[model samples]
Target chain A: MEVIALKKLKVFLAIASSALILGGCGLGNLSSRPSSNNGTQLTGHANNSNYQSVIKHGHYLTSKSRGVDVQQDANQLNLKSFENGLLDLSKKEFPTNKYIFQEGQHISTKTTEHWLDRKSQNSQGLNPSGKETKVPLYLQQMDEQDFLTQHGKHLKLSGMTVGLGINSIYYYKKKKYGPTYKKSISNATVKAEGHKIGAKVLARLRRKPGLKHIPIVIGLYRQGSDDSLVGGNFFAYSVNKGSSIDGWKPIDERNYVFPSNSGDKGKHANDANDFSNFKSRVQNFFPNLSGVTAQAHYINGSLSGMHVNITTQFYSQTEIIAFTQYLQTAAKKYLPSGMPIDITVKSTEGVQSFLARKSGSKSFSAHVFNSY
Target chain B: MEVIALKKLKVFLAIASSALILGGCGLGNLSSRPSSNNGTQLTGHANNSNYQSVIKHGHYLTSKSRGVDVQQDANQLNLKSFENGLLDLSKKEFPTNKYIFQEGQHISTKTTEHWLDRKSQNSQGLNPSGKETKVPLYLQQMDEQDFLTQHGKHLKLSGMTVGLGINSIYYYKKKKYGPTYKKSISNATVKAEGHKIGAKVLARLRRKPGLKHIPIVIGLYRQGSDDSLVGGNFFAYSVNKGSSIDGWKPIDERNYVFPSNSGDKGKHANDANDFSNFKSRVQNFFPNLSGVTAQAHYINGSLSGMHVNITTQFYSQTEIIAFTQYLQTAAKKYLPSGMPIDITVKSTEGVQSFLARKSGSKSFSAHVFNSY
Candidate 1:
């Protein structure tokens, strides 16, 4: 058994030695052959040269278009060569230059300055020299007609223009011509010794014919504090009696009123008797004023202190101005002689313009100033 | 018409005076009144003493239970009304104390002592005073059993004691064992080299049945490295052959082998032929040693540079010890000279115990070392 083992061992040794010699000569092709094919295949020399030229052309175009100087040593090609070589490059470097060209044509011209000057002349009613120039009465009429055509639905006025003239110069005022004035008054008694009495007046005027420049004023006041004259006066003029300028006139007492202490205690007494005298004087001008009512609120639980509200209305601008002037004259007769009362005369014309000009879609204008 | 108007004016004046007096007295009450309920019906006491007392009691309970002190001041009470108030206060005053509680609970008493003594025992076994004495073999066996119970699925050997011993006490020597050692020659048939060759021999003796102690020496050697018998010896041992001491005996070549140079070159003329001669020697010692295989691998790409791997199963403890001694000797002979080589001869008992003790959910102690 030992001898057989020895022979077998000798045979194994000879085989192992030969295998080693063969392996050393690089016959072991098992693990390295597949790695060489990892790179992309090339079609031919033509494809390679085409790809190079395309890339060179793309670089040249980009540099020239951007106004950058291409280096002298760099290769440059014409547009034709660029187009031919573009397809041969790798998809990653493909040149995509898409340009559109068209031929030019001619047309006539008109400048904006001509139109602007015409509009300026039309809007001013006079040239830069300030003469009493007319843009032909018919043209003026046409302009007004156009304005009415464009903005009539938005206009809150009664389309009446009242003309007021001081000597020959005419000041044209427009007021809304709509419903007749409405009035309501309060009559509840107050216990306070001195209470504030307030009145709200609503009035409207209708456009009248043939009155080229009709001037009118409106006012409100306590009866005994003033005479037959109105306590305050608001002024307006009509250029055309019945035109686009006429509309429903609104009197906003909070604004337009002149500053004065007309409502103070000593000058305008708060006694029920004094209020009765004031009411008579107000009614003398506004004969149709009615539905008067009154109420009083105690100040800090004191019956001796109260405030009152009285509301009334006038039928027309003529009546409003007539009543206000009567109150002014009457107040000069009865109240404390030197009491500087503030008579705020807000024109129905001004208020109507304010309400009419405001766009219906806008809740309030950005330019409006709040008084309260 | 004029007479009717005059009568209306007189009536309006009568009503206006009454409204003015009421308004001046401030009796108006339109917008200020609460519509839902009377003023007296909504009255309630503003004092909150009951709420204050309840909050105080809550503060006291929270502070006492959580080891915090509650301040009696009003401002402190106000601040502590929030949810994290006490926690925020404790962090501000006693930050480090938080870690104290965690550290005290995490470590066991024994582990704490282990950490304190680990540095002192790192270079040597135990202190001379025996404060850190070697754990008794019985204790080590118990520890192994407990480890098996807790983490048996992870352990590589089951039902075996892993005793810790000093490195200096183990020894290695060289000599030959059985016939399977000659199989190292077959590996030369394949050009495969760099294979590691290993062998083992074991013997269980029944000397005089009841002998209290018997000294046995084992030796392993390559075929022609040394002339003197003692000089060729690779491992030696002396132990009691009786059960009066401990029932088990285990020696690991990893702890016992002493290195030497012998088979740095092949034993036979062909050099590569030494692999078969070595295998023949191993087979001679264990006749039933089945599953023996030999493989060859290239060492440094040369035919003469050959290595062999030999594996055989062992049945008994004596066989395992004898086998380990044989391998120690062969490794000393054939392994390259002047280099430190690691040769491991673990007990079959150790391996079996390790396998059986493994836990499906647990991993080996190697993980612990790697983590460190």
Candidate 2:
């Protein structure tokens, strides 16, 4: 349910670009921070309590960092993917049942702001400076989430994650309210700069007494532009050893917008066709459909999940229920297996029905909203 | 507008009871608070940047208190009305152009917790002492908003508003996993106790150094039960001078669920018939509608706004556009004048279209969501 709620928060866009990294929070000057006890903190949560709450988001204390991501990124989809994708990756290391999670407290807001700026005489920024057209500061924003372990009455920090949001296209102006120029960041350059920044980040962070030895997982994310339909993806990440990251693991995550003529769907041609068949089946079953669309996800060029959205002309709960039931049949017949897929039905009024099928589930579960 | 966004945040309920108060934040132990510079602060905004951002909702600095009300009051609709209605009432006195608003920062969480508890054992709650069901605590939660004015480069607190959320029905359990009992709070008791609590709150708040001389507006709110279809409303509020709330003004706010069989229709019979006629016209024009419903808001027993939701069975955008046009005509012919009304058209997918017309506007403006 939280997955769907978070999905609603992202702005619907068209397909764009991506690249990657993921990491969490580490130790900080504990006394300088505000009390972290404002929200409901949980330890050893029930196995089935996977739902997200502000205090504990599936074993992570989220610190209510919901809206700040878009401040620099300017793309809602990029913000969602950057935040949620990093969490998904963090789970591989910090198992929900084995460890507790909290928002990054060690990395101060000032630190992130300073890190994003281009290096200058007055500031120590991560991005290379004095070459505006050459370097063009790719790093936009950074977020940290800390993993902790229970030690008596206190939860001791064990590991952390760091997400680096890089710009796919840089926009700048020579004067205030003047015409803005754009520069596209190539995949090769993004990878190079992102790695350079990550290495420097590790070296600087290692000097802090609290962060000296703890491993840090850094993720490099290439952001989508404001008009982009698809959110950016994590391209590369490195699981560290002591103060050094031995190697960067290539994270090949891709998205295909359904009903596309985009030629890049080479290996994913079958997945695209399957999505097309699913859309047609649902549309054929309900001829009154206004429009049907989907954004399919793939990992290493293999299908993983599909999120479908349908907008309708009617405001009927009974119709929504019947259509959703029919959709489950179409999805089972035409969609990929081994991962969860979801569909949302809507009319001019609002969300009418939601259907989702988990990987292990045989059938889809549906919810039809009551309209009074 | 923020009005509709706030409405969506509320859970759809089936007529609920309500009551009132409204206020804002003032000065605190200034030095101890976190830096309020995290958000994009605006001093004198444009004539119309009415859309809501996390840092600012309309002219108010929201402090991201979006999901906290349900912590104390389980009903989501009550949370929306309790927060938004307080701002609406405060706007009458504060006026957006002259004063800027921010979330209540002065009343610490600890203060509100102590204030809401039933008076006893290390608690100085406003609610009276242990009499069990005979004197159940009515006070649920309190929120404040601060209004500020620019004084050269500095912004000074000009005044404040406070909102009191009261329980309409109290539910409690004696032991863990035990049967829960409900106690109904009568209007007479709600009024007497609310007034008494309001006066005491003023007396206590005036003692704080930062609050002594400033004017305060308090709105008393009655929260609806979880299953109620309609949101709660503010029943009464008072404008204070110095330490005293001069005289309370009864805010006669009411909501009517259309096509109800409940005999309370009386004088509203004609208005009800008008609504039914409008529904019939739309249904006759488009036989595929799933359902049409309206929540008519009245101030001083006169219709001020009608939020109509029509769910449809068709997923056709063309049909939605045409039906919305037909709806505009029907609305103009049947609905009351001098107040803004909005209609949302949705199916199971999500919001398909939104149609709204300001009070002075003669026709409704429509938006059809892009299905892709």
Candidate 3:
């Protein structure tokens, strides 16, 4: 009996050691293995290259997009792999000794099973099929307040706890000999929780003492039937706290869609340049205007709203009317059809706004905030 | 020369000592005094009874009002007197060694003169004739975040720095005398700086060894020409921050005109009881509804917006429409006519909103946030 027990222990040790060695080498096929708990199989290159690419794409997506799809429990294999990918990326990107991505279980039995089943059946996770679900991403010791102490103390410490989880959909493709699903990282949910994740990532990077500044990106995912990649959103937390959160103030995340790629110019990379151009165009049309500034809001990759703030030397009702007309025309010329644009004309005397809505033709409705 | 110098010193010491003595007794007529700077006269009864009453009224108003008036530069006398009254009240109520009302030059010269001049001329501070201006209230160490730490750590801290100020018009008439232009407290600028005065008051209280909890009120003055006394606004900070401020997330302060007095009774009273009655009536009509909550937003004791959040076991479009109709009838019966009421109907399956804008008749517009 003693000899048999010794043999079993030896065998277990050998297996564990081999697994460690393969993991250390980073040569094992992560996708080939089945997730022990869930019967679902994960399909992805789950290697260094894949993780780096996703991280790179994550930064890109966050730079470009405002909000992303937060999905959880739909495909356990994909979810676990994707989570692993994020964790690996965080570790590599930050190289922090302390593991920020500590594991926890945050699955909701109410919506997980049903949502997963629906995902398997239907592609679009439409609202009509069922109520929009909230999935909790398991995180332990994500104390942003504590993290801020060790990190940049000058940085304003805002605590954010996310409620919903991210979701990704993959199609199963047969490779002649065996059935293997192809990984397609679709809608990764970007909300308060996602911002928390971004903050955590930033915290890890800044945790490496003396790292004063870290470039942060809000993540937004594409929501089309065929779109694959996610967009990086520059703005994360909203100007105001959103709905509600238990431990943190609900700060709504912001996203902006670029109009066009600035005529494929090498000089300008971000959408801010396009906004500047829009401002210049408005200013050129009305040369008398002072301090013209344009702000564009993008959802996914499409312009949802555009705001133009201009300061004039003096404001007149007639001049405002003419400017509103010109702005309506400019909206047609520059912005994508059916988008909302808010043009605020300000002077030392007063402030007025032209809220432009696109029907068939652009119509500018005006509101005077301050009387001249 | 020595004799004359000695005499002069003696005179100076006498005046200083008398000032200190009067200050100790709290007997100096604070109303008939000039604000140390800005060439503005302080008004109102700044003695104990008057200050206490105003403070009490502040707490009362805060407890009652939804959103209150924030005015500045319009009525210097009332504004200054109100400031002093608040300071005296804070000192008396707290009874601490630390001085909360520290003297500082907070008045901005940019808009104060123009605004004050306008007030002297026109009843309404209308622009075009002159600029309806903004006044900046300044302070050295306005630490709201620190104040939040000591007061209520769990309380969400939102800092709102108001650009415009508050104005309060007061009419003083003796029984014998006909009427007097008793100073109008116009535009007492409430911002981070103003809150500093509040923090200073709190600090004074907290500086004491054993003072555990301090009852503080963020004061909002009454706006209407006929409204008697100012109401205290309880929910000082908006749930979310409003515009921008230095060293803090911009939080907009909110004041609610509470519907009826929650009986400490006649000593403290307002219209919150009517709102409560309305809530009861609705619940009585629909006994099956779960979690029915009625929140009323009042400006200067008038209902501006009313929100009704209710939970139902299930949702039906027809049932919602019928219930909306019932609510419309109820609004007509109970609430003020032509006020905007937002009805958010929630169920286990979904949530729908019925936004009713009272025109000739109550028009109910519906939006489904979720589907069953």
DockQ score of each predicted structure, in the order shown? 0.00, 0.02, 0.01
Best prediction by TM-score:
2
Cα error of candidate 1 at position A196, Å: 90
lDDT of 1 at B328: 41
Ranking by TM-score: 2, 3, 1
C-alpha RMSD over true interface residues, each candidate: 49.9, 24.0, 26.9
- Model 3 segments beyond 4 Å from truth? A1-111, A114-256, A259-372, B1-261, B264-274, B277-335, B340-361, B364-372
Residue A63 local lDDT, model 3? 12
- Among incorrect, acceptable, medium and high, the docking class of model 1 is incorrect
Superposed model 2: Cα runs more than 4 Å off: A1-372, B1-40, B43-72, B131-134, B174-180
User: Scored by Cα lDDT, where does model 3 land?
Assistant: 0.32
- Chain B structural similarity (TM-score) per candidate: 0.19, 0.79, 0.32
Runs off by more than 4 Å, candidate 1: A1-26, A29-372, B1-162, B167-245, B255-372
Q: Give TM-scores for every candidate, taking all chains together and pairing residue i with residue i.
A: 0.12, 0.46, 0.27
| lDDT by residue for model 2 (B270-306), tens | 6778888777756644546888878777788777777
On residues A221-273, what C-alpha lDDT tens digit does candidate 2 reach at each position?
88776666667888999888677777999998876677667565486787777
Least lDDT summed over 10 consecutive residues: which range in candidate 1 chain B? Answer: B137-146
lDDT of 3 by residue, B1-372 (tens): 000111001111112111111111122321222111111111122122221110010011011111122222232222322332233223433332221121211223322333223333544222113322232212111111101111111111112111222233434444445654444443444343334433433344344332223233333222223332222222132211111111222322222333444553431133456666656655544435776655454444455555556776533232343345445445545655576665556665334334444334555443322110
